[model samples]
Target: MPSPVGHALGGAIAAVLIAPRGTPTGSGSRLMALRARLSHPLVRLGALAGCLPDADFLWGRHNMETHSVGAALAAALVAGLALRSRRAALVTGLAWLTHVAFDWLGSDDTPPLGVMALWPFDDRFVFAHAYLFEAISRRYWLPNFVTHNAWAVTSEVLMLAPILAVLVWWRQRGAGPRV
Candidate 1:
């Protein structure tokens, strides 16, 4: 939600994974095509627009659902409806979900009320906000919303492999049309 890293990671995964599912014969090609579509200024603007509102409009106390999952889904759904691409919808959903998932693990609070991460299907929202960012001194506050948690250290040391792998696979699999 803060840096868009989680959203980008999730979008990449969903795009690559869904590409193959949508067109089994041309999985890579579909991925590339979708990537191109996603990269468009219109699509990027749309995604950012969807994501930025919560950060801009919402108040403090960590609006997890609106900031992460809710916003992402709203963006994806809008983009999907506007573009008429189910794949686009899928990718956007994944992006939003990914943002939520990351926050869940990084913190200790449960999700906010009525988050509806899987809206129209699931009614529950996650509300975990345990991570609190401190400066390098571990005493002072950072400029923006950077949280410090035990899991942050763990995430840096151990969990990075799978995350990196997923990222690498997403980008590589989504690149170029195969002959």
Candidate 2:
């Protein structure tokens, strides 16, 4: 299966393309970034919560809907309700869908063959291969999220460093909070 980077990279690309194009505003950037960051932890927790189907805690074999489209959409909608930012929700949804798309393309399995990302909406799924093969056996594929498992819990703290630094700098420069 593809790594989180692969998933997020796909998300980022789709976000760039599908994100609303309007006056470049800090609010938009903040919303997009937060949506992306927030989705990560949410997806992780959702997996742990057993709310996400087809997901195995150790194996990482799960449907894309849990970690991608459905989860993302749910998160975005909640964020939108709380923050009233439609753009944020849009970015989150797009990012999620992008993850699903990438998974479809990169995963060796698709729909009936593998994960069904567009379940309920569609039956088709993109199919590909694992990004990292077993270290001992290159023919076999490795699991995704291995890189982030240890650090997944600290994501918010990790994100805070840069977000705070930027915010403080912006504040010191007399630029008020945009959103």
Cα displacement (angstroms), candidate 1, residue 58, comes to: 5.5
* Count of backbone clashes, every candidate in sequence: 13, 7
Per-residue lDDT over 30-64 for candidate 2, one digit per residue giving the tens place of the 0 to 100 score: 56644543343323332222222324335754554
My TM-score estimates for the predictions, one after another, are 0.47, 0.43
Model 1 weakest 10-residue run by lDDT: 130-139
Candidate 1 global CA lDDT score: 0.46
Top-TM-score candidate index: 1
| Local distance difference test scores for all models | 0.46, 0.44
